[model samples]
Target: MTGSTVGSATAARGLRWLGRWLLRAKCWLALLLLTAVTVWWLSQELILVAVVVAVGVSPGLVGATWVAASPRSFERLAAGPWRRLRWRRVITSRWEAVCRDAHLAERRRVERRSLTGERMITESWRCPRLARVRTTSHAMELIIRARSGQTVTELEAGAERIGSIFDAVAVRCWPVSGSTVAIELIMRDVLITPTIGTEPDGLVVDTVRLGRTQAGRDWLLPITGRHTLCVGASGSGKGSVLWGICCGLAPAVHADLVRLWGVDLKAGVELATGRHLFSAFARTADEAVRVLATLAEVTEQRGQAMAGRTRQHRPAPSDPLHVLVIDELAALTAYAPAEVKKEADRLLARILTQGRALGVVVVAFVQDPRKEIVGMRGLFTQTVALRLRSGEETSMVLGDGMAKLAPAHRISPATPGVGWLVEDTGSTDRVRADYWSDDQIRQVATRFRTGVQAVLITPTEPVDRQRERSRRVRTPKAGAA
Candidate 1:
C-alpha cells in the first residue's frame, strides 16, 4: 500500500477545482449576457416602447424576460394532452442551479404559508422564440401569515423552499410582514471537495479503536480544517465530536504548520478540557471581543508580511501555515453584546470567507444553528451534525441537501459523547462516524499535542479563494462548451 501510485487517485479527488472554475465562468458569462441584454433592451428607446406596448396589448401575450436572457418568460404557455405528451420526450432535460441563501437580516415574526393549491392553470403564457417555438408558464403560489412572536428568518427560509419546489408559496412573518419570495430556480451548482483519508472514521476520530486491525478501519479523515460544522444539542456529545476533530487534527501540530484556536463558551468548562491541544481559547464574550480585536490586528500584520514576500513563491499552497479551528463559535454570538457580537461574527465570517489559502482551515461548532450563526449552512464544506431536536433543525443545520443523510439522528445531552459525521459527497454516498470517550480523546490529544507556534493569521488566502471559487464554478466535462 505504501508503494501504491496514488497520483491519479488524488488528482481525481481534486478535479472539482477545474469543473467549478468552468461552471463559475459559465454563470458569470450568463449573468453578463443577461445584464448586457437588459441594458441594451432598456437603452433602445423604441424597443422599450415596443416592450411596454407588448405588455399593454395583452398581459397573457407579454414575454417578460430577465435582462440576462435567462429562459424566464412570462408567456402564454400551457400544457395539454398534446404538449404534455411532447414534454414527456424532453422530460429528462437537465435543470440545475447552485442555490445559495444568505441571511440578509433576521425578521421578528415569520408568517405561515397557507397550504392550499390545485393543479389548474390560473394563468398561462406562450414563449415566442426561434422557429416560433412556444412554451407556457405555470403558476404555483401560496400565502402564509406570520404569527405574533415567530421569527422571520425561519419563515422566509421555509417560504423560499415552498416557492421554489412545493408551490409558489409565500409565508409572511412578523415585524415587516407581507414580504413574498419566489422559488423559480433549481439547484444545479454542486460543491465538490477532496476526500482526504478514506480510512473509516478518519473524517472524524475519538471512536478509532486502539488496535491496528479494527483501528486502521477507523482512520480519522481530516477535514483539513477545510471547513467543518459540528452540531449537537445541549447533551448530545458536542464535546465528543470536538474531541474527534482534535484527535484527527493531532497529526498536523508537529508539522510546524497547524495552529489551533478555540472559542469555548461553556465559560471554558466543556472546551477548556482540551486546552492542552488548543493554543488559545475565548471563554467569555469579553475574552472573545478581545480575541477578535487582536485578530484584526494580526490580520493586518500578516497581510503586510505576505505582501512583502518575494514573488517567485507567490501563493504557494504550502508557504503559509495550516489550520484554524473554532469551537462553540455560536456561543460568541449568544454571549457577546450586540456591538462586540457583530464584530465577532464579522471575524468568524472573515475566517470562513478567506481562511483557506493562508493555509488556514476552519472548523466551527454550534449547538443551535441560527441564520446569524454562520449565515448560510451551505458555506461549510463539510458538516458533522451530532444530533438535534428535530429534522427541521437538522435541515436548517445541514441544508435540505442532507434530507436523506440518514434520518435526523437525535442526540440528547446524555448521549452527548457521540455524533453522526456527514461529509460533502458532491453526490450520493453516505458515511458515518461514531462516538468516543473523554479518556480516549485525552490519549490522542496527549500524543498529538506539541509546542506552540505563532499563527500568522493572514487576511487573504489567495490560493484558497481561487480554488474555492473554481470548485463553485465547475462546468460539466461531458463536452459542455
Candidate 2:
C-alpha cells in the first residue's frame, strides 16, 4: 500500500479508539475524582481525618440502626429514596435488553454510506423511554413514555416478562395518558402475612374494614350502596373474605343498622356457625329461594316508598340495610332444580338490579365465575378475586384485560386470602382479606346478634297424613280405651 493510504488507515483506527474511550469518559472521570479525594483526605492529620470520616459515616450508621429498629419509618424517610435511585439505575441500564426481549421495542433499519462509498444497512432498536421511577416499601413505580408503534396494551402484555427480568414478584401496567404508561414492580409480597380482623367499636354502616392492601393501607370495602362479588377457587379463602365483611359489620348488625340474610346451600355448613349474626339463615334450595324472594319484595317496597321522596336509602332503626349473603351462589343459580333455579335467578336479578338504591345489597361468593353460572355477575359494583384457577377465570371475575394486570391466578396457594380488588371504575389493587377463624366468627356472631330472629317458612306435611293423625287423636286408640 502507498504511504498516504497507510497513514489514513492508522488515523482511522486511532479515531475509533478515541470515540470508544469518550463514550465511557464519565465513569472513568468519576472514579479518578473519587480516588484523588480519598488520597488527599488521608494525607491530612490523623485526628482531622478521623473526625471527617465519623461525620460522613455517622448518618449511615444511624440509618442502619433506624432500619433495624423501625423499618417502616426508615423506609418512608431514607430507604425508599435509596431504593429509587438504585433501581432507577438498574432499570435504565437494562431497559434496552428488556424491551427487546419482550418485543416492546421497535426495530428500524437505516442505510448509511461507508468511507469507501459502499452502502450498508444497519439495524437499530427504539425502546420506550423511562420517564420516572418511584419507590414504595414493597414496590417500584415506573413511568414510561411509549415509543412509536407501542401501546399500553403491549406494555401490559409484557409486564410478566419485565417483572421476571427485574426479579419482581409481579408487575402491573396501566395507561397514564395517551402516550405514557405506568408500571408497578412488586418487589416483595406484602400479603404473605395474614391480617387479623377486629370488631368495630361503633356502628360502621358506610364501609367495612376487611383487611390490608399491598400498600399497607386498610382495605375498606364500601357496603352501604354497593354490591360485592367474591370469586376464587376452592380453598382460596373465600370464607375469609365472607367473614371479614361479617366481622366488620358486627357493630352495625347489633345496632340494627344492618341485617344479614345468609344462604349456605352446602347444608348450611359454611354459614351455620354465624347464624346469630344473620336475621335469616337458609340451608336448603327452597329456603334460599324464599329468602331471596323476601328480599326482592322488600326492595320493591322500599323503592315505592322512596320513589319521589329520595334517590338514596339511608339505614334507620326501623329500616335497616339488608345484606343477602350467599355462600355458594352457583348452588342457587346454576346447580339447583329447574324450578328453584328459575325462581332464584329471577328474584336475585330483581334484588341486584334495584336493591342498591333501596338499601338492599348482595354479597355472593362462588368458585366458578362463568357467565353461564352467574349471568348477573356484572351487576355487582365491586368484585374481589382471590387465587383463581386460571387467567380466564380472573378475566371473568374482574373483566377483560384484567388477567394481565391483576393475575390473581398467579397468587400462591399458600396465601389464601391474597387477591386483587377491582372497583367499578376499572382500578385494581392487590389486597388480602383477614382470615377469620371459626372461633373468631363465633365470637363475632354471638356478640353482635340482633334481638330479632328469622322465621323460616318451609314445606309442610301432606293433608292426608295430617287428617289421619287428627282422626286417630279424636277417636281414642283401643289400647288407651
Candidate 3:
C-alpha cells in the first residue's frame, strides 16, 4: 500500500506483460527484421541476384547435406520438430471451432450486476482446452483437458467428426486421467502393407513377434501364460494369426521347450499342411474331443504337480509349455453333435480356466463370437478381434463399448490380419499379423519339426469303401435279381 511498494509492483507487472507480448509476437518481429534486411540488401543488384539464387538452390543443398550427414538425425532434430510445430499451430487455430462443431463445447447463461447496480445476462461457451499436440510419421496425438462439464463419452462420440474435419483416416480417444483425454488421429494406414512372418532368435516363450502395430511398433503376442482367442470373419486373416504364432514358436518347439497340438476341425484341411510341427493333430469331431480331453487332463495333472511346489510353471525341456491351437472353434463348440459338443465345451472350459498357470495355453480361432456359440469366451485372457460383422460382435469379443475405441468392425475386408488386440487390463491396440503362405508354413515346419509325429485318429474305413459296402447291402444279390 506504500507509494514505493506500489511503484515496484506496477513495474514488475509491466515487465511481465511486456515479456509475454514479445514472446507472442516473436515470429512476426523476426519476419519484419528479415524483410528490412532484405530490402536494404536488395539496393545492390548483385546482392539481390545472389539472394534469389540462394533461395532457389537452398532446398537441393539442404537435401544433399542431409544425405551426406545422418538422415535419422535430420529427421529427429529438424524435420520432426518442424512438422510437430506446424501441426500444433494448425490444430490450435481450429481447436475452438472444432470443439463447438463436435458439441464438446459447453454453454452457460450468466447473470451479473454491473457497477450501475443493474442486472445483466450474458451467454458464454466453454470449449475443451488442447493441452498438447504430438506428431509421428503417420499420426497426430492430441492431449485435451476436458472442461468443467465435459465427459469422455462426449469426446469419444465426436471423434469421427473430428477425424473427418481433420482429414484423418481414423480417430481414437482414451482417458489419460480423471480430467484429461488423449486422442490419436491416424493420418495414414501403416498396416496396409503386409509383412511376412519372421522366426524369432531363440526360445522365446513369453511373447512372440506377430507383426507391427499401427504405431509401427513390434506387435508381440504373449503366449506363455495367456490364452488367446482370435475371432474374425472367414478370410479375415485368422490363418495369418495362427501361423504367425506357430512360426514364432518354431525355435521353442525344436528345442523341446514348447509343445504344439493342433485341432483343425475343418477335416484337417488347415492343420495338415504343417503336421510336422504338431505333437498331436486332430481333424474329426471325435478326434478333436479326445484331444481337448487329453489336454484338460494334462492341465489338471500339472496343476496338482505344481500346487505347492511353485506358483508359476516354467518352460524347460523336461516340462515344456503346451500350446493347443484350435481352428474353427465353433465346429466343436457349436456345430458338432450333442455328445461331442457337450464334452468339448466342458473340456475347453476347464483348460481355459486352469491352464494359464499350468503351462497349457489354448489359441482358438473362430468366425463367430456369439456367447451362445463360444460360451467360455470370457475365460480367455487375451482377445484378438479381426474384421467383424458388427459393433455387437466387437463388443462381445473385446468387452462392451470397445467398438467405438478400437472399431474392429470398421476394418476393411481388403486388409486381412488387421485387428484390435484387447488385453486383460482393458487396453486396446490396433495390430496386424504377419502373413504366412503355405510354402512358408511348410518350410518353417520342416526346418523346425518337433520330430514327435502326431497320433492322427482317422476313420476306420475309407469313405468310398464304406459307401460301396452300404450300396451292396441295400441292393439284392445278382442271382436273386
* Candidate 2: stretches off by over 4 Å: 1-85, 88-133, 143-165, 177-180, 425-428, 454-481
Candidate 2 lDDT over residue span 1-481, tens digit each? 9988876765665455445444646665465556556856778566655555566445545654554455577668776777767887888888899899877888899999999999999999999988987777788888988887887777767777888888987666677888888888888877888877776677889998888877666888999889999999899999988998888888888988899999999999989888899999889999897788778778878999999899999999788999999998999999999988987887888898999989999999999999999999989988899999899999898888988778999999989888997755455789998888888889888988877666654333436679999998899767884
Q: lDDT by residue for model 1 over 366-416, one digit each (tens)?
A: 777767665645667667666677777777766675544433454434433
lDDT of each: 0.46, 0.83, 0.83
State every prediction's TM-score relative to the real structure: 0.44, 0.69, 0.72
On lDDT, the stronger of 1 and 3 is 3
For candidate 1, the 10 contiguous residues with the lowest summed lDDT are 185-194
Local lDDT at 192 for model 2: 84
The candidate that wins on TM-score is 3
lDDT at 92 for candidate 3?
A: 90
Give lDDT tens digits, candidate 3, residues 252-314. 999888999999988899888888889998888898877877787778789889988998999
lDDT preference between candidates 1 and 2, better one: 2
In order of TM-score, best first, we have: 3, 2, 1
Q: Lowest-scoring 10 consecutive residues by lDDT in candidate 2?
A: 454-463
For candidate 1, what is the lDDT? 0.46
